[model samples]
Target chain A: MKHNPYAALPATVENIIVETSNITTFTFRPEEPIPFKAGQFVELSIPGFGEAPFTPSSSPAVNDVMDITIMRVGAVTERIHALSKGDTVGIRGPLGQPYPLDKFKGKEILIVGGGVGLAPLRALFFALAEEMDHYKKIILRYGARSPGDIVYRNDVATAWGKPKVDLMLSVDKGDEGWKGNIGVVTTILEKNKLSINIQNSVAVVCGPPIMMKFATIKLLERGYAPENIYLSMEKNMSCGIGKCGHCRIGPYYACKDGPVFTYDRIKDEPRIWD
Target chain B: MAKQLKQGCTINGVIEFLTTGCRVYALSQTDSNYHLTSDEKWESDRHMLGPHRPVEPLKSILFPPRQGVGRLLEDAPHSSPKPAAVIGVKNCDLASLKIHDYVFRDTEPKDPYYIDLRNNTLIISCDCSRPCDVCFCTAVGDQPFPESGFDINISPLPNNQYVLESGSEKGKKALDSCSDLLEEASQDAMKARDTARKAVYKTVEEQAAVKGLDGNKNYQNAVTGSIESHLWERFAEDCVECGACNFVCCTCHCFLLADGRSATGTSERVKQWDSCLYKNFARVAGGANPRKYRAERLYNRFDKKFNFFKKVLNIYACDGCGRCIEACTGKIDIRDVLKEALDEA
Candidate 1:
């Protein structure tokens, strides 16, 4: 029998982690292992509640379980946020192209993220750490609304807390006891805390459209080539396939050609920030 | 295999033959629109061949407006339906089908539902012997005849007679099966068919030339250049968000999948047609809307048809059937919009 392309494999929520007030991460164990490289997305469906496209927040190396970090934003997401451990859902994916790790082999990598945009970056981070010695160094600059809004707080600080890794973090605002950077994530980039060879470095950015807009400008000003700057773009991707024309950005379908794209490739397209 | 002529075959005979094993839906002209109907007999007095494409797209029949794709909790619920034959299809509609074929068939992880229905369905197309006032197919580098992508083609002669030519083996068999109702096409009828084709092309070509739509065939450059133009703002002034243009358009394929409960109380995921003109079409979660303005949505529709598809498929998605011109209550003419947008500084 020909397989149903829209049929999502049944999955059970194995674990749940509260990242922030609105954002939470759910680890799901599906009927079949959903193997995906970093930067790829999946359609997560709640039974009878509809589906939404989300990037798997877990490492591709992990075979049995996949992680999805979601924010309570829309109707389907509201139900997904209400899901607890042992709750059954659906998953259809390993869709879209993964981040081209092959191109970043000998280059210094700058990973920048904002808000819950850190989810897909978290997956890419794990993939990059698995092969730490292959690259020169890793510079990660992440920002959120406030200190409390930071995701994977413990992991972000300690996971790559090695000699070659410079994990710089900031927030839009700070609480009383906050001692790290107290400005937007771009402020950290302005400080240039880490010594990155701009000519030999490729920057990967993900976040809200506003942050991505400024971060891209900041990266370009910092002598990074447009081709070297990677972005994880998001729009309303209903089918998670090219058939649906919803997530179209210029000639490329965000669902098919990319949720991940280079700044140079799409700079001339209209309304990049929007 | 030769052009087994069906000289005096009436549309009734063709519809009668097509309705044998499968269902048949032939286009019946209402006062203003052309819609497919499955009545026992079609309009005999009116010309059998279409002057242009019907306002209702062929996508509505092949892909369906709304259908259950699969179940939310249970096994895959619905199966693809039995084959059905559609008649009164114009060349513009056939061009629209090519875009659908590329999207649903040539793209990755082929749509099983679309593939099943299209594979089983036979296409019986007709040439547009006359151009509708709104039609500009010749302006956009497309002819008023079916060059390919059909089982059989019916070129109309005077007196409601048709010269049936088979495009596929199935069409040949269909003609052979209805041999009793047909005769060899005469030399006069063949010559008349060629004359009618040129006449219609001339009419549309002249209209396009007068409106300056013929030379500005490079739509990609026009739309991309005027991304920030004020013309879209003016075009969207009288717009009510009815999305009739999308519904009438032959190549618009945006869809939304919503979970709904069926009559049996079983929940299913239904794929339904969606329009980019709506406020929420490209809106994502967390309230960030890319196309929040009506002007942006309006521009997006043109950009997809003229620029996006041209860059990807090397063909403009608009076949210039001009169904959108009649369907829009706002009275927005697409030809005028393209002409003005192309000339916009």
Candidate 2:
């Protein structure tokens, strides 16, 4: 029913929590709680500045407060880094159609994320973790360029230590103290033998496009159906609604129609591997 | 009542009749091209509604290129101005505007800025007596003559009086306001208006007779086998990726919502147009562009037009509006490219 694409209501910047050297978790309290599904993102606006789409790193269950982990890469993010705890910002969305969570129920779910792409998937991880009894298996394979690039390291590590989640952390290159998996994330998927069955499971992946492209092929090799493989897309979105055609991949608006789509849905689109 | 205007008739009289003090827009020629200009300057009797295909669209006045979104700014407080009569909008532009409305003002609303502008504007469509070579509305189920969606439509008659027809409440209001300009209806006046309008339609139809894709059915599946064709590479090579095609395109509405930081300590989120043809349009956080090659970008552009838009909106992305063909610096005709792709496939 809500139609305005650029309507980012005023939100208060609760605090700026540091995640990695480049990435930080921005906590904000909106005028009203923007309750959204785990995989959905909001267009965060810095009034007089600009807006960018971000998924809340915090759990969707915690409605009162929200956290968006941002990697300072562009102008809007640079301004976001300079803002203080009490600064005022704006937010529109919980936009785009969220991931089809109900369909994933009772299936073995695999979450593979790379670097800052884990921010959006983090919400999914927490949402699934909240209702751990519903799904059969929750396997999270998270990787970064290096140990420092990893986000939510402590929380994810602590979650990995738990019996409910089978969480694995890997880095492309690891230091002496890293002692964890040292290789590409796809290698971990290939080497490790788990109870991952493709027929009844959906693999949700978000990361660099090359990583996703290769990771998708790897998942397909492991018997994951093309339709069963869900991909959270990151494109050039200006209006988090269908109005601005910038984020359109084929006919689908990355903002309104999807930031999340199945492998079969977008497999035909050219240059998705880049 | 719609009526035709004479060669020597003053446009001010038409404006006075169209708007009893309400704002009205008219097409005037500037630098030899017809633009959707207002009444401040209407010197030449030679140009009526200019010619056709203005430098910009009537949509620009209704929906400006850039405006603030999200929370409204104090200094630039967002105001939906009262609907003014937009006169002399050609049929091609009108058809393109329909597509824009479908994207921005459909069942799912887009920007409130667009809605406000659209809500306030009264469209007065005119029949293009002279359509250009690139005009192809007839192929896309639209004629050069005004169809539905106008508040009021006009047809120029041989006599000094113009035949006016009301299409909506706004049209009736405008006519009622200008009652002093009206005369009793006569059979000869009606016949003259119809005759002139028919002649304009015939001229436009003859000029726009090009082979167009079928309107009722979807041609997306027909394009599936053409993906691997070398035509994509050939077209990509010529494309400088300057983004003129996408920017000038009526249906290419890609935009980026940027948060602007003013030196005045005010932060604003402004939504500006963007193009997928750009290198970094699809680059994510880790600096990876999915559409790395120009070939892929070109394919994506055509795919959006031929394949994607049809899949979602049940309408082919391209409406046979030839703005992209005319605007491209590479001189790439999408129609020819699409035809080649289909043929080679």
Candidate 3:
């Protein structure tokens, strides 16, 4: 009998964190720890509902438990929002290419995340933080629709906003009580006047298609090379092992070749933003 | 080894002889087209088992439309079909097995079910002596004759005789089983088979030329360059999205997996055929759809067959079987579309 790649490992919801009105973070303890690099994703399934691919938001260094931040969207995510602690779900991956942390060892690493796009970046952030002395510098520029929509509030305010890392947060329209930057995340890069050493730096971007498009243009204008920009692409990933052919971008199978790809690699791919 | 089935032996007699050791499926005439039928429908002289491809592709027999996969309940037993012989398979249909091999067997983590069916089924391919109006096998780097990928290929000759050529060890074994009904191919029979093959190739070439499809155009390059062509929208406007084209296609193998729970709480995962034409094929979370337009979906089907499969598998997915043209509800001919796209490119 051939090995069925669709089989899911049973996992129990260990904890739940409500990040916003529409978004929640579920921490699961599987029967076994799913070892994966920072940007890889897993196909999470609630038995009655269906499966969807998600990147773990927690550090890859953490064993036994994984954190998946999900925004309530469509059927599967809506069902996931109704799930509580101790609920049983299925997980099938840790598939796709991960962030090339080895390449950024001696270079400055800049991450730009918009909305829940920060989920994967949070994992990369912690993974990089573990090897703090290896990289030159680490920076994050994150944005959300509003002050209420920010994810990982406690972690961003306490753990991730340390002196060793430069953390910049922004909202499209800030509330009256908000005291942080009041424009898009790209604007924070300009307003803060952060000295980004483009020659020796690499930028990882993940967000809405429009945000990523504009952010990429901004990065290119700032003298960052095209090959140095990494993108976390989100397509309709059915089988996380690349057999389904749903997540194809030109000649690349996004599930296997990448959910993570350098900008130069995919510049010629058609309808990438779409 | 080459052999000859005697002129007096009826098609039903040969089928009966073959079926004594294995189940046999052959073409039986339906109201509109020919379908693969077993002993109950097989007739000696009633059915015309030659000259055209069948309505249902050979892929349906190998990789079924739907099958239960993964763990099953103790009460439910999955029994694979016994070893069988498939006769009257056209050369165009046989060509697609090469692509299916690349997909289901040669790929990593090979599909055991497909491999099992492939191992058990004996393919008896038939050469197309009379090309159909829509047939264009020559246009896609193939002739209306089987070169390989079959256990036995039957080239028809005059006076009810057939030139049988064994292509594999299984074929030679099957031929050896029925050695009493066969004889060594005479020089006259050999010349007749060669003449028949050349005649069929000429007719297929003539039909393709008359349809303006006989050209050395690079379909992969044409489809790659025609991604932005407006012709796709024009052609796709009439599409009803019934997905008959994909269903009838021999190479389209996209599938969807779903879990069905029984009354006893045992869950079974079932694999079902899926089509790219479906609106939700490319829809992701948060209501984002990449190929939302009907034109884009239509273009994707051709693009996958000509461009993507060629780039990945080193073979174009389409073998010019023309089943898609015959099965289309909107009468959208792939040949015309391909020709127009190549011309524009």
Candidate 4:
């Protein structure tokens, strides 16, 4: 029998966590365990509705259960948000290039995420936590629209906290009760605010396209080498195996060569920010 | 390497040989163009292979326009019929299998759907006698006739026969099964076919040069450098996003998956032809569309064919089939765009 790259395995929605008004975290239990690296994504199916590509928010360590943090943005996502617990859905993946964990060993790791883009980072967060002693430090600078838009609010500190981890949170518009800074995420990357060794630190960024573009420039300004900076180049990876031809960034497919490419690798590629 | 000639060969004889266990399709003359279809009754000699490729792309055969690529909820037994023999395939379409193979089969986790059909299908190519007005194969480092890459090539001779040459092991085996329909080729016939191929090549080269579409000029440099140029905006003015150029070009292999049902009415996913020319081709789930402007999409088409593929595979994706020039109702000529881009640089 020919191997069908598009074949989806059965995965039941085990739980749902409403992260925000628009974003939700879905925990699915696959019939077969899917082992994946941190930054790789999966194509979650809604049976009759169709499928959408999403990065897993759950730990790569856990194989049977997977958490996908998704926001209601389109037809497939709209139907995905409507899926209740115990609903069966088809899933295909562990696709695309994962974060370069081997390269980050013995170095400081700075994770920058915006809005729902923190989903794939959460997976990386867990993977790095498992080997927290391997790296020098882990710093996360995350921002959202407002206090209400913050994801994993219930246990971000408990789950992401470590001895060497420095976590910073911010919002574009803060409420009266919001004691944190009220500014964009790039503002947090200022000279006085961040105290990482520029040569020792590597930055991994994921977020909206505009946020990513600005964050990359900020990281560059902070003396982060283009090779030291990794970007999650999320295009419309229509076919997760790179056959669909939608996620082409220059000659590379985001589905195959990346979705986790270093800034230096794709700096010359055409319209990357787009 | 199996070259043979049939003294009294007919198109029906070729069709009859191919129709034993597989479905055979040949181009049926439709006005000045041709449509590839299985004919119940072919006209006396079926000489309507046409001077160039059909308006309908060859990709529509192997990688179907629409297919139910289902991930069945329930375990179901699957079966697919094996073979199809497509006749009178032009060199442009034949050469384009390189692009399709690279995208669908040469890459990792190969597309089972595309590979299945492509492997099962047999190509019976023919030497083109004349070039169409839209054709510019010589410009893109190609010839009117297929030098290689065909299973079997039929070059028409003056004696109302054809010299059949097998270019693949499959063609050699296929010829063995149908040896009764063929005769040994004379050295004179082989020389005649070679002479005819060269004559058409010269004519095509002269025609392409006249339009300024023929050259060894670096399309990669021109197209990649002109990303910020107003050339795209100017050309996009004449463009209506009909996607006829994408559909007609054999190299355009982009696709989109949608929801659909199979014949059993069971739930399934449908993967169909998609175009970069489409407004939302690069749009994600979010309201963000990278190629929002028509000009961006137009520029992207050239960038992929000229810059992207050239940098990666060292081959321009365009075969100069000129189907796009014919298919465009907006009358946006690709040759004119390339010429202008080269001139600007």
Candidate 5:
């Protein structure tokens, strides 16, 4: 029988983690292991509701279970937020292109994520942590709306803040008990005393469209080549393959050609921020 | 070998002969236009066999408006589909079918449902002896007659007989089975068929030239360059968002899949036709819509037809059939849009 690309594999929710009031992480053990790269995405479906594309938040090295971090936003996501352990759901793919970790070797990797966009970067961080010795430096500059919006707090505070890995955290606003830097994530770039070798450094950015637009400008102003900066693009996608034209951005189909594309490759396309 | 029916044979005789073995679908005349109907008897004096394309494109018969992609149970019984023969297919619709074949069957992981329907059906194409005012197949590098991709091609002669030619082995077999109803074509009939085909091409070419839609310029480059053109906003001003143009288009095959559950706890994923002109076509889960404005959506529809599909599939998604022009409630003519966007620019 021919494989139906739209058919979802039966999966059982193995675990659930509440990362924030609106964001939750659901772990599922599929009928088969969906081996994927750290930056790829999957279509998670709640059967009768419909399917929505999400990037896995857990390490790709962990094959037995997959973790998808979702924020309660629309109809499909509201249903996903209500899902608990032992509930049945469906998974379609480990779709789209992954980050080029091979190209990042022996170079300083600058990973910037804001809000729930940090989920895919977390997966990349875990993958890089496994091979920490392969690179000169690994830096993560993450920001969220507030301190309560910070995800993977324990890992960010301890595991990712080792001597070799420079971890910087900020928020748009702070509570009374908060003592960290209070500003948008880009402010950390201005406040940091560390200098990055622009010739040997590559930046990966994922966030809200506005954040991405300004962060890309900051990276370019810091002397990073357009080709050296990668951005994860999201659009309304169906048929995770290229058949459905929903995710199309100019000549590129975000589902097939990319959810991850270098800045230089798509700089000419219109309305990237929209 | 080319075959011919007698000089006085009516369209009803042909329909009866074609429907003998299996179901036959043909164009039946309606008040405004021709609609596909399965009624065997030719009830209307105004009904035509083959001169013009129908109001509905052939894609509706092959890939239905709504179809089941997945069932709740693994072992659900699927009924065997009845083999069908569709007659009066115009060359523009055939060209669109070629594009659809590249998308659904030629690509990786072929769609089983579309493949099943395609394999079970026989295509009977007919020549366009009369080109409509809106028809512009000549502008898109397509002829008013079928060049390929047909089971049987029927060319109408001057005296009402048809010169039937076979394009595939299946067509040859069908022709052979109906030998008793047909006769060997005469040289006079062949000459008349050639004259009629040439006349139709001339008419289409003259019409296209008058409208400045001769396909001379590089449409792909012009459309790609016009991303921010003010013309799109003007077009959006009159568009009602009824999606009638998309519904009547020959190659607008975008679809949305949803899972519907029954009270018995069984669910099926149903795929339904979707239009990019709709407001929510590109709206994502988190309310980020790339093509949010009606102007942007209008621009996207033309871009997909003229630019993106050509880049990916190496063929324009549109066949210049003009059904969209006929179906548009606002009377938005795509030929005029192309001329204004590509030629006038």
Candidate 6:
């Protein structure tokens, strides 16, 4: 019998910190910190229950303590919700390609996020924040189905108040106390004064497949190069590694080559938006 | 002592030597087609040699179907060791084994059981006497005989003698241990091996009539638009997603991890074979299948073959072993499907 590497890892869960209504953040430290690039995801499991892949909501720089924000829309999430701090679960990886933050050096970066897609972008956000002086500018346009669906709302507020980061929030259906814009994430981009130069600007977009399509088209219309638009793809990935045939879009493994890919690299693949 | 008639060892002598203690699996001819089994009663005059290069290759005997991948499960009882020898291994399967070696035998370390099985087993390869209609080893620049990655490679020789060559150190040892049956070969015996191999090579070349189709640069394109095309419905319309094609595949290495409680009441993780053809292969827990349509599921098979497999491993996933066509209850031919895809372009 072959000794599987993933099963050998401690299936011990650290603590389940419920971050929001639809989301629970799992905080667990692997015996060895999985040194990974931001935007990569790990296969989180509740031994004998089920497993799912999720990007670490925490920064990549924080190797010891890793946080994975999961939405309560599936079996694994429901099991994860039943747990509290110090419950044991299994975690495998820090898998897949990370954000290309190196490409954004000395360039103005625009992060367009919708719903729980903000989890991965948040890693990139803090990574950039640590080296704030190196970047020219950082702008974030975030939206969800409602104001409640938005994650890291308070973190975005602090980052916005820091003066170095410009942040905008929106919702599809605004409630009575809503003072911010009431529109899609695309509308927020159109309303903003975004300078999209082909040479020195990158827009990292992640959302539902429909939002990703329109947001990518909108970014291209605003002078962003096809190669400059990075989209974090959310597909059903079981392994979070190249071995599993799932999460494959053409020549690339969404888990390994990318959950993050430039539009130019994968534009020719069929049904990619879906 | 049993009489040894050479030109490839006498069929009886080889079987007699193999059945000592080792597990010997060979092709047994039933009424119509040949099946591989160890049941001595079912054994026929049919040799271990494979005639049709089925799309279902031989990767499964070594790699588990769907098993625990990265998860470490509590150790299960190691399967009882039975030293074995499988004969009539082909060239395309041999080539794919090299790719498998690279994947599993990483310097950083990987697949301990896979490495052990490959290391321990004695692989006896023989020359292909005839070529299947879908056989294209020559087109891919592969020979019909076992050239590399074999233990003992046997070439049919004239005058009832087999030209036996030691392919690996294990083969050398295996041959050395069988000193009573072995002898110093003359130049004529070597010449006989060359003639027999060339005859098979010529047959393979004639069979692979689709010129310039060997090195498929269009594989990426075939995989890219495969999902959107009607070809999936056309080819896989009758496919039941039975997973036979994947199970017998030489390179389909996807697996699933399961946790089971031991008789000792301790939980253990077990890795088992997985097939992409299954309905739930890509389904998430909430029932949102990104590839819900049959077309998308069928298309992923090709994508894994041409796109994902090639990009990561730098080798074609399909080794030109025609096992899938042979195993398909639907009679869907992969060669025809691939050719149609390339032609429609």
Error of 3 at A236 (Å): 1.3
Model 2, span B298-326: residue lDDT tens = 88787777676667766665655577777
TM-score of 3: 0.93
Write candidate 1's Cα lDDT for A1-274 as tens digits.
Answer: 3667778888999999999999999999999898999999999998777899999888889978998899888999999988889999989988899999999998889999999999999899889889988888889999999989999988987866877788889988899978898888789888456568999899999999999999999888888889999998889899998878888888899988899999988998778788
Per-candidate TM equals 0.95, 0.87, 0.93, 0.96, 0.93, 0.86
By DockQ, is 4 or 5 better? 4
Runs in model 5 deviating more than 4 A are A191-194, B5-21, B39-48, B72-80, B176-187, B263-265
Candidate 4 chain A: 10-residue stretch with minimal lDDT: A154-163
lDDT of 5 by residue, A1-274 (tens): 4567778888889998898999888899988898989888998888866888999999999987998888899988988888878988888888888888999999999999999999999999899988989988988898899999998778788877876798888999999988888988888766353368879999999998889988899888888899999999988888777766688888888987789999998998878876
lDDT tens string, model 4, A38-103? 999999887766888999998999998999999999998999999999899988888988898999
Deviation from native of the Cα of residue B200 in model 6, angstroms: 3.7
Per-model DockQ? 0.69, 0.53, 0.40, 0.69, 0.54, 0.33
The full ranking of all candidates by TM-score, starting with the best, is 4, 1, 5, 3, 2, 6
Order of candidate numbers by lDDT, starting with the best? 4, 1, 5, 3, 2, 6
Superposed model 6: Cα runs more than 4 Å off: A1-4, A11-15, A191-198, B1-33, B38-57, B66-84, B106-109, B130-141, B176-180, B201-229, B258-266, B283-290, B306-315
Candidate 2 chain B: worst-modelled 10 consecutive residues by lDDT: B209-218
Per-model lDDT: 0.84, 0.72, 0.83, 0.84, 0.83, 0.70
Q: Of the candidates shown, which would achieve the greatest TM-score relative to the real structure?
A: 4
- State the TM-score for model 2: 0.87
lDDT of 6 by residue, B149-210 (tens): 88877666556576667788877776666756667667777777778888877776766555
Tens-digit lDDT track for model 5 on B223-314?
A: 76777688888888889999998888999888887777768777777778889999999888777888888988888888888887888788
Q: lDDT of model 4 at residue A169?
A: 90
- lDDT score of residue A204 within candidate 1: 95
DockQ for candidate 6, C-alpha atoms: 0.33
Per-residue CA lDDT of model 4 for B1-345, tens digit only, reads: 445645565756665665556766678777878887764433436635566677777888888888866545655345674687788889888888888988888888987778878878778888888877778888887778886887877787675767887888888788777777776777888888889889888888887787787758778888877777899999998889999999889899889877656567677776788989989899887867778899999998998999888887878898888999998979999989988888886
Chain B TM-score, one value per candidate, order as shown: 0.91, 0.82, 0.93, 0.93, 0.92, 0.80
**Stretch of 10 with least lDDT, candidate 4 chain B:** B39-48
How do the residues B1-345 of candidate 3 rate in per-residue lDDT, one tens digit apiece? 677877577645655665566676788777657877766334566545666788889988887888766542122344666888788888878888987887678876567677878998988888886777788888888888887888888888888888888788888787788888888889998899889989888887787777677647699888878888898998998788988898899888777766667577666666678888888888787777878999999988988888888889877788888889988999999988898788777
